[model samples]
Target: MLAPKRSWIQQVVYLIGMYGQFLKVYVKTLVEYRADTLIAVIAGIVAQGSTLIFLTVIFNRIPTLAGWDFYELVFMFGLAATGRALNQTFFNAPFLLTGYIRNGRMDMMMVRPVGVLFQAIGYSQELNGVGQLITGFAIMGYSASHLDMAWTFLSVLYVGIALLCSAFIQFSILLTISVLTFWIQEVRSLIYPITWLYDFTRYPLQIFHPLLRGLLTYIIPYSLASFYPAAYLLRPEQYGWAVWGVPAAAMVIVMMAYFIWSQGLKRYSSVAG
Candidate 1:
């Protein structure tokens, strides 16, 4: 006899429960390895710390860069770090798709009842992102306190939503690049150059040349992940569009990524004979 099909809501609930189980096991493993977790956290802290030092040196020479004060720039840095950390923490498995495909692990996933992408996303979480999360939030809190802006509940909620949308944009981009592995079977070279674009988003968008600003705003939209959202919070009149635009862009990019992944999956071939 055939089994009954679940409704959409039921399926979503099932997936959430399954993901919870995955998290339980993942956390248990992390807890089992105290040294590894500590090292990963320290690495994240050091990485962000170096960026902070560089910013400090630049500010020491001048009061502001491109009309943005030191704390304002720090706020953007914190937003970027937080968004990147979220991507690393939850969606990092896409980076390993090349190996998974080459080793027939993807073939194994194909036979499972769960969706391939869901299983892949739940496969592992980056412990180092915990460190990044700490530093990012700490920096944001410190900078916010120093800034003259008022922080009400609504403002906090808006910032939280912006951060989630920023992370979504990044995850969509990474997943889109990873999907190329289905055809090329290796995407490290392509991914590196694209990821380098994110460096430009660490500073004020107004400072960059018009061409570079256009690239970040329209082509890759990395600025939506950091600069635009941060700017919307810091200077609402100047970047008011981001209030609607960031989430809209995230939805569009994620839809595009999913379509590409589906197409790539259809063309996927197994290495096994």
Candidate 2:
């Protein structure tokens, strides 16, 4: 039988505890295979740098995108990078659900005392976060130097909170996509579209039409993962709304994601169970 549903705060604490345990195992596993880990880390950093460079090239040709200047765009990109990194580090393994199910790993997890979803997402160091950290901070620095902002202590704290919410959104979206494994049986085909959302993230919602942009900002809100945070970081005076909206939206999205994942879990059929 499944564990009884707990209070929201308890659920979060449980998940965090699971993540800590899994991260420890992940690090130990990587330490055993140090050479492969080093190679993978380096390759990941190079790939991240290439992506940032491509963004720079695009901005060089087009001065401003949807009224968002270059540095602002870069800031959004940085936020995107950081969010993606966190998602990959923590929740990306959910994408492996179908394969695990097909191969009987789901049965193994079911026998464990911890929650299945927690065990799945937090199973592995993501070995790649280090590289993403480097490239993401580099992108942030580039934007910080070019963009004008009064960085007070409060502002920095707000920005940090915004970034964390962005990461939460990123994790939620990936979980939704990955949960399809219960039906699709294979998800490699979906990776590109989910990753493409990162491209859409680098600009303001205004680049699209008013209706489309509005829908994106509210309904789907993937772009908001970065653009909203950048709005606060770049033009905090004009977009004071983010001071409230960012966390509120993140809370809503995370709740929605949790609900969806629970339904997906109910739908999952264990070959062994």
Candidate 3:
């Protein structure tokens, strides 16, 4: 006779436990490769640092960019960085999907009992993201000290929700790109240009031309992750509605990406075969 089927709750619990185990292995790997992990973290910090340097140089010349003060822009950058760190830390495995597809690893994953997407998501944990998280929070804290912002309980709660939504949006986009590999089998070229568009989100959307702003807001929606949330926190009266919209956009994008992934999985003809 067959074994009993797990309930949805039991399945979720099992996945969570499995994910925790994967995370422990990742931690162990990081510990074993201390220098490599440190270098990776430093590279992340330096990349963000370069942006900070650019911001400093630009702010020195001008009081504000598109009506946003230096601190305001920094706050937005920090928000973006934090969201990106969350994505890199938890959902970066999509970047490695090409290899999995090429090297017959996808075959192994397909034969496993777990959901493929869950396995893909938990495949890697990036230690480098820790550096981005450090800088993101530090910059946000420093900027908040300079800005005249209120830190009410509601405001803090909203910030947490916004960050989670932002990470979800980013992960959905990456997952969608990875899904394309299921069809075309090579999409690294497509991923970079698309993902690089997120840099536009580090500053105020008001500075960009109407067309670019529309692209960022609607098509890519990176601005929702960085600018809208920062704007809402900085000036709630002006951008209060975004608190609702961010989560809505995240949910929609994630559902859409998951649908595409499901379809792609069905269409997938394993490279091994």
Candidate 4:
């Protein structure tokens, strides 16, 4: 007889337990490479900081870009950074699936009792995420203090929901692209272009030409990751509907990614005999 299906809560608890074990293992490994972890975190901070400095220089030359002031732009950048940091921290290992596939490591994961995607995601940890997390929240805090929006319990709750949706969207995109390795077997270079697209999300969507704006919003939907949510937060009456799209788009992308990933698994061929 077939086993009973697990409830949603049971599934969530199982995932949490799996991730907790993964974290324990990751921490143990990280302790062995403390210097490397420190350097990685520092590098992340410097990289993100340089972007902020570049924005500062640009704002100094012009009061606003596409009608968004420095603080508003910072808020957008922070939202993108926070989403990216969450993906890099917890879901980035899937991007390395190409290496695993090429080396037959993926076969080992398939033989394990746990879910393959879960194992793949928990395969590694990134210390650089700590720096991005710090930088993202610092800019967000500074922007929040300066912005005219009224702070309320509901507003804070909205921010949390938006961030979660944004992070899911980012993770789904990364996973969908990474799953290409199941067929191509060498897609390491493809990740750069996908990540480069995210750079466009650091500014208001209005800055882009109409065609480019449409492409970002419809084709890749990068705008949903940060722009729409930031817009909603900055001016709820004006952009409240856009914020609702964030979770909707996130759900669609995640479902699509899962479909692709599941199909890709069927196409996977072991490199080992």
The candidate that achieves the highest lDDT relative to the unseen native structure: 3
lDDT winner between candidates 1 and 2: 1
Each prediction's whole-model lDDT (CA): 0.86, 0.75, 0.87, 0.82
Work out candidate 1's RMSD over C-alphas: 1.7
TM-score of each: 0.95, 0.83, 0.95, 0.91
Q: Total backbone clashes of model 3?
A: 0
Tens digits of per-residue lDDT for model 2 on 14-53? 8788777877787787788788778767876787678668
Provide the global lDDT of candidate 4 against the true structure: 0.82
Model 4 misplaced stretches (Cα beyond 4 Å): 1-8, 29-32
Candidates in descending lDDT order: 3, 1, 4, 2
Clashing pairs for predicted structure model 4, backbone only: none
User: How many residue pairs clash in each candidate at the backbone level?
Assistant: 0, 0, 0, 0
Kindly list the per-residue Cα lDDT of model 3 for residues 1-273, writing each as its tens digit: 232499999988888999999999888888899998888778877988899899999989999898899999988999999988888888887788888888888888888888788888888677888778778878888888999999999988988888898888988887888889888968999888888888889888888899999999988888888889999999999998997988888899999999998999898777757
**lDDT: worst 10-residue window of model 2:** 122-131
What ordering of candidates by TM-score runs from best to worst?
1, 3, 4, 2
Worst 10 residues of 3 by lDDT: 1-10
